[model samples]
Target: MAAAAAAPVWSVDPRTGKRREQVAVEATAAEVDTAVRAAHAARPALADRAVRAALLRRAADLLDAAGERVIEAADAETALGPGRLTGELARTTYQLRSFADSVDEGAFLDVRIDHADPALAPPRPDLRRYKIPLGTVAVYAASNFPLAFSVPGGDTASALAAGCPVVIKAHPDHPATSELCAALLRRAAADVGLPDGVIGLVHGFQAGLDLVRHPQVRAAGFTGSVRGGRALHDAAAARPHPIPFHGELGSLNPVVVTESAAAERAEAIGAGLAGAMTLGTGQFCVKPGLVLAPEGEAGDRLLTALTAAVSDTEAGVLLDHRMRDAFLDGVRTRAALPGVQAPVTPGAGGEHTVSAGFLTLAAAALAEDGTHDLLLEECFGPVTVLARYTDEAEVAAVLARLPGNLTATLQLGADESAGRDGAGRGARLLADATALAGRVVVNGWPTGVAVAPAQHHGGPYPATTSTATSVGTTAAERWLRPVAYQDTPPALLPPELREDNPLGLPRRVDGRAEHA
Candidate 1:
């Protein structure tokens, strides 16, 4: 018999440039099968709304209890500061609790009903509709946001909230944190008297591929680079029973400042832009990669202030050397392009650090056919591009060429009013911004994403695999599918869809919504 191959998981500390901990061995194909089957088996337990809510709350409590240890491990592996990691842990726990509330409310099911009507020319039969879980979800972890976007992150929380089991493929960068989180979640499931495999953790590249290919995995969620997300998306599609793949690939989230707005808030906007671009070393997927500003005194003042702010900014280390190398390479590529000038040239600050910076280019350059088109893509670090526009027409044209983003911001002047009349200059700009991004900000930056009910963290195409979100309360919607019960008996129908409304769920009856 042939011997099995070994996959060792190691934690590399970015700050020290050394491997600090050996987390675990990667899961083999047989182990992957075991995890998936266990998750599939646990789907029955998840059917109980009370059980689901309890499990989520237990997980949140356990995470809260392990607060200090979790934060320290995450910071040790990711090199994200203790303060930042602590804040991320808070957000992570808050998201878990939020999902618990969502599961308890049961509104994510979206139940509806219509009685039989035989009097009309073509009367419809009795019909009812409500969403159900799609089964096990394979969640791919992100390198950044170790706690919030990894192991016990939004994807995992949303899946569990939707009554779907999650098998998380831990990001290679933070294996220790992943293991710790998985243990806490498993303990929570046990405390709630749920199945052990409600949350599974696997390490290594092969396990991730196995997860997507497994027939038991009915859906998947990912937050990562375009290259990786695209590959996984294709693999999931090629499966016999293709599942929903909600992959949040990166974005070049663009911003536009009206000439007058820049004039009025030059210093404030400049400092704010500097802060946004460098937030988390610009690791956020929604970091503004491009900005459209007019060419005049206003533009110059903004650029000068922005340059000063960026220069004043201290050097910072990235997640890892691999990310640092990529950031440097991307900056070099952009700087070499025609009409691209490095106003704040971003590159390696030292053997271990990356400096914040920006690039300048004429807005017309973006309208050109070939080279400038690359500027529309994300650079993935503390770097941004300033697209200088000569006129309003040029600004509009530049915005049109950009791809969809998770967010698009338009800093408007005092005179600029967004009204339906279409007579105002910025009013017309609203439509353009709306067409480009999922979340439109009029006078703010895109770095700080809130965890709220109305939040939308996904956008068109490359921004995400679908229009569904991977954050906030509505994120669970991605892991669900609607089923219609036509001419079905009352007892045979789901409690939420039955005439009695035993579950006390909100539903629409006879084309009218009923609160009870």
Candidate 2:
């Protein structure tokens, strides 16, 4: 009998349990361009609305079909419980379908046309405008969201739908899962008669930098720590021809609980905060990292509930060893600071596990000196800091000092603004805090990121470089730029913007809105 082939040995990292393997790495600048060129060459045909939508739907189908298997692989690699991983898979698929729906709606094309009016002074000419695809996109798959933000995630899906080819710099934290997902996406592209290069995945730190620096890579999407994202952002900016780098970096999502709300339901708020902080081991960028509460009984009651809730909670593994180390070190630093009290110390529960807990300090201490201000930094794990204020004005002061964030939540009592007097105060406070964040939430947790039309997922600097966008149907706008064609014959216009517009899409004609 012929000798049996040797099976590839994949060792799993205990921190995230991500299976490790030695895959062929893309080595040269020329190889990087080849990948980008392949995508660019395939762009024209894939730009068709029907073609893009079908491919997106097919990708969704593949993910749906392999949902359980993908979840199993992710769990085996990351140790994220099946329940959460399964939900992540569902969210990831929903995101794909969401982009497909956006394409089907066709509003993303944003067509505008102005016909010639020679009678006007200076002999006005016909002008028509439509969004054109950016050439090729480089996507940096995120570790926290291996499924949703990796290979087949928003960046890849949105870029592909925009007719911009994508080259993914796979997040090393979950390379194995990234490989599987990328293969499935490539197969989907082939099924739709599109080039396999429509999606590409490369491993290694060097390979990622090469992909980002490749002359043909027109733009990139990143989700990671502030340090990592900033480095890539600078590289993209410093290139000979700078490109757009849409990145969602660090955030300390703060939640404000009014005195009235705390008085009515301290325990409920504590329990809810615990769930949000510890969800997926505090891996979400939107995790509530800070809490601002009023003083006296309400604050005491909140502390009591928070302490009890955190103490009872068990430790959970982070996405990787680096994160685990940061979490432990953060707890140690905060717990050691003067005037800082951890009613519930979120210490290391196991070798690779840490508990969800909180640290409390007087607002005066934070205001007095920046020494204890380390509390303001994000711990990047299942931990939160509660800052107690003596008055509403103090709370407002602290809110003013807060850095840009992805989300800022307000926990209001039912009658928080029922009367004119209360409404004025609440409105002013909410407005001030809202100005400091990208998305403002009222009476709900910021952890649940809903995929909806009005969602603004991006935030101020550090939260995201571009304040105007986040990962949504709106994200497609980033991969496209409007080109105005002047004095063009109807025959020369793109089919979608022609006078007889066969697609029946909404468009601006002769300075007025029209359909079909």
In TM-score terms, which candidate is top? 1
Compose the digit string of candidate 2's lDDT tens values, residues 1-516: 985433333436646445566544444555666776776677777778878888898999998899887887777667787898888888888888888888887788888887778898988788888888888899998888888888888888888778788988877667678878888898888898888878877766666778778888888899888999999999999999999999988899988898878888888887888888888888889999989988889778878877877777778888777778888988998889998888788878787777778888888776654787787777898889888988877787787777889999988776765535444666776897688788998877999787677888888877888865656788888899889888777787888777777887888777687764
Worst 10 residues of 2 by lDDT: 3-12
Ten-residue segment with the worst summed lDDT in candidate 1?
Answer: 414-423
Model 1 stretches astray by more than 4 angstroms? 418-423
How accurate locally is residue 154 in candidate 2, as Cα lDDT from 0 to 100?
82
lDDT of 1 by residue, 146-185 (tens): 9899999999999999999999999999999999999999
Candidate 2 accuracy as lDDT: 0.81
lDDT of 2 at 306: 77
lDDT of 2 at 259: 83
